[model samples]
Target chain A: MIFSSALIETAVNEFARMPGIGKKTALRLVLHLLKQEPAQVQQFSEAIARMRQQIRFCKLCHNVSDEEICSICASHSRNKTLVCVVENIRDVMAIENTQQYNGVYHVLGGIISPIDGIGPDQLNIHSLVERVQQQEISEVIMALSPTIEGDTTIYYLSKKLQGVPGNPVKITTIARGIAFGGELEYADEMTLARSITNRLPLENYMQK
Target chain B: MIFSSALIETAVNEFARMPGIGKKTALRLVLHLLKQEPAQVQQFSEAIARMRQQIRFCKLCHNVSDEEICSICASHSRNKTLVCVVENIRDVMAIENTQQYNGVYHVLGGIISPIDGIGPDQLNIHSLVERVQQQEISEVIMALSPTIEGDTTIYYLSKKLQGVPGNPVKITTIARGIAFGGELEYADEMTLARSITNRLPLENYMQK
Candidate 1:
C-alpha cells in the first residue's frame, strides 16, 4: 500500500472508501486507470460525478429517474393499479429484467433495519402510503428481500395501507422458497419450512 | 443489465470498463456511490481524474512520481550504482514495502510479450540501456515476474546492456526458486527444478 505519488495515494484512498474494495484492490483499480488514455479517464470521472449530481428520484415511486417521474410510473402499458414495492432501485431493475411483471414499482429506498439505525420513517414509506391513498391502486405487491427487515416493512406498510378507511388495497408478498436450480438437501431449515408451508398445487408447479 | 437512469447507465459503463469488474459489480459500485453525499462523490470523482491527469513518471527510472524524478531516484541515501530493474511502478512499491534493499529502481513499464503485441521497443528498454551506459552503475538486478515474457525481456535487456563497450555493468537476476515458506511437496515442478539447480550454500541459506 506504499504509493510512490500523492495523486495515486489520494485516488486509491477514494476508491478504497467504496464498499467491498480494500487498499490492494483500490491500488489495482488506480493502476488500471493509469494505463488508460487521459481522455478516457476524464470521461469516467465525469460520468460518475454527473450521475451523483444529476440523478433524480421519481416523484411517484422514489425510483431513480432522469425526469420528475420514473419511466415505470409514467408508462401507460404497465399496470398502474398493481404496484410492486422493492427495497431499492437495483431491485426495480432486477424485476424489470425478469420481464414477467407488467406492474409499476415503488422503491422503498431501504428496509426497516433497527440494527442499522434505518427505520420506517427514513424510508419512502410516507410517500408510498400517500401514493396508495391518492390513486385507485387495486393491489400492492411487496417484492422486498426475504429477510426479517423485509417482513417488518411489509407488515408496517400493510397495516398503513389498510388503515385508509374504505380503501381495501389487496396486499401480497413475493413467494419465498428454494431457488430453481438449488439442491433440496442444501436448503436451510427456514426455507424448507416455508417451501413446505407454501407448497404449490402439483398442476400449478408443472405449469411454472 | 437494464438501467432506469441514463446517468446511472453511463456511470455503470465507466466502472464496468475496469479490469475484473463485471456489469453487476459495476452497478453495485454505482449504487454505493449514489448513497454517498454529493460533495463526497464529487471528491471521489475529482481525485481519480486528477490522479490520471497530474501524475508524472520519474524521468530517471519511469516510476510514478509527482515530480520529474521519483523519491527513490532523488534520494542520496540510496545507492546510485545498484539499480533494481522492475516491470512496473507497482513492482517498485512491492519491493519498497519489503524495506530490504537500499538501491534505486528502473521501471520497464511492461514485459516483452508477442501475443499481447508488446515488445522490447514498446517498453522502456532503450532508456534503461542508456541509463546504464551514462551513469556509474556497477550492478543491475532484474526483479521482473518469473514468466516467459519476463525472461525474454531480461535476455533482451542483458544483451543491450553488454553491447555497450567498456561499460562492464555486472548483470544479475532476482533468484528463481521455491518461496521461503512454501511446502516442498506442493512446489511446482519448474520451481522445484530451479531450486535444485541453484542450490545455495548452507551458510548463505541459514543467514537468509
Candidate 2:
C-alpha cells in the first residue's frame, strides 16, 4: 500500500481529532494545505500556535480572553450586575453573535457530569460565587444547556451562592432558552424556547 | 452578548478556512484545544505546522514524501515499469489500500477543470510525460475519477504520451473502480469494481 509522508499523516490525524472530521476529510484538508503556498500554511500553523500561546481564561469570568479579563468583563459600559453563566466559551460566542445580551458572562468550563468525573469543584464555581459576593451583582443568569448535567450544575451553584453574606446574591437561570436534552450551540438563533419561557423568580430560587 | 477573546477568535477563523468547517465547528474545535493541557495544544499546532515544513514532494512520483522520493517511488522492489497516474495524493492512498496494484504511482496534483480555470498546464502533466519519455516505462494507467474533468485529463495525457520510445508505452485507464458520479475517496474498499468491468482500451478511447 502507498503511504504518505509521516508529516502529512500527522497533520491528517490531527484534523481527524476534530469533532466530525474523518480520515478521508482529514486527508483532503492536509492535501489542500500541501497545495497552498508555503506562506499560507505557515500562517495557518502560526494562527493555531498563537491561539494557544496568546489566549487565556478571563480572571473574573473564566471565558477565553487575550488579556487577564475578557472584553465583556473589561468593558465598563456592560452591566456587571448581571452575569450570565454558561458551560463553555462556545456558548459565550453563541450569545455574542446574537448581540442581545448586554451583561457579562461566567464560563463553568463544563457541566456537572459525574459519569465524566466533572463536578462543581472541578469547575470555576468558586470564582463565580466570589464575583457575586464581591461585586454589586444583582442577578446571576444560568444559560447552561438543558441536559441533566446542566441542571445539576445549576442546582449545585445556586445552593453554594445562596450562603454568601451581605446582599445574599440573587440567582436565576435563563428561562429554558433551550429545549429538554437540546444543545445550546445547535439552537437556532431565533427559535430558542428558553429566552422567555423558563424564566423563574430569582428570589424564589434563593428561598428554595 | 458575550464575546470570546480575539486570539481565540483568530484561531477559530483559521480553522474555519478549511473546507466544510464553518464558524461553529471551528469554535468547537478551538474550545476543545483550550480545554486540553498546554502541551497537548502545542503538539496539535506543531503537528500541523510541521506537516507543511517537514513534508516534501517525491521527485519521481510527485506524491507527498518525507525524503527526496516517496516510499512507493523509492522502493526498488515495486513494479518500476508500470506507472499509475492519478489526480491527487488521496487517489494514491485509495489504490494503495486495495493491495491489488503493485505498481508505482504519479500524482498529477489535480485534473483539468476548465470551469475552475484549471488546464493541463496547471497540473503535473508535463512531468508525467517527461517520465514516460525518459524512463523504461511500459503502461500509464489513468486512475482518475469518471467526471468530465477526469475524462478531459485522460484524453489530454493519452494524446501527449503517444509514440514515446521504449517498451511501446500502453496508455490504459482504471476501468470503473469508481461508481458513476462517485468520489474516489468515498468508494468502498471491498466493493471496488474496476478490476473487471471498468477496463477499457486506450485505442478504443482514441477512437472516441
Candidate 1 structure quality by residue, lDDT tens digits, A62-109: 999999988888888988999999998889999999989999998888
Taking all chains together, each candidate's TM-score versus the true structure is 0.93, 0.80
| Per-prediction CA RMSD (Å) | 2.1, 7.2
By DockQ, the best candidate is 1
Q: Write the per-residue lDDT of candidate 1 for residues B84-197, one digit (tens) a residue.
A: 999888899899999898999999888999999997789888888888878899999999899889898889888899998775999999998888788999999999998999
Candidate 2 per-residue lDDT, tens place, B121-174, comes to 888988888898888888889998888889898888888888555556898986
Candidate with best TM-score? 1
| Interface RMSD for candidate 2 relative to the native interface | 2.2
lDDT of each: 0.91, 0.81
> Worst 10-residue stretch by lDDT in candidate 1 chain B?
B158-167
Q: Lowest lDDT 10-mer window, candidate 2 chain A? A: A190-199
Q: What are the runs in model 2 whose C-alpha is more than 4 Å off?
A: A177-208, B113-115, B165-167, B177-208
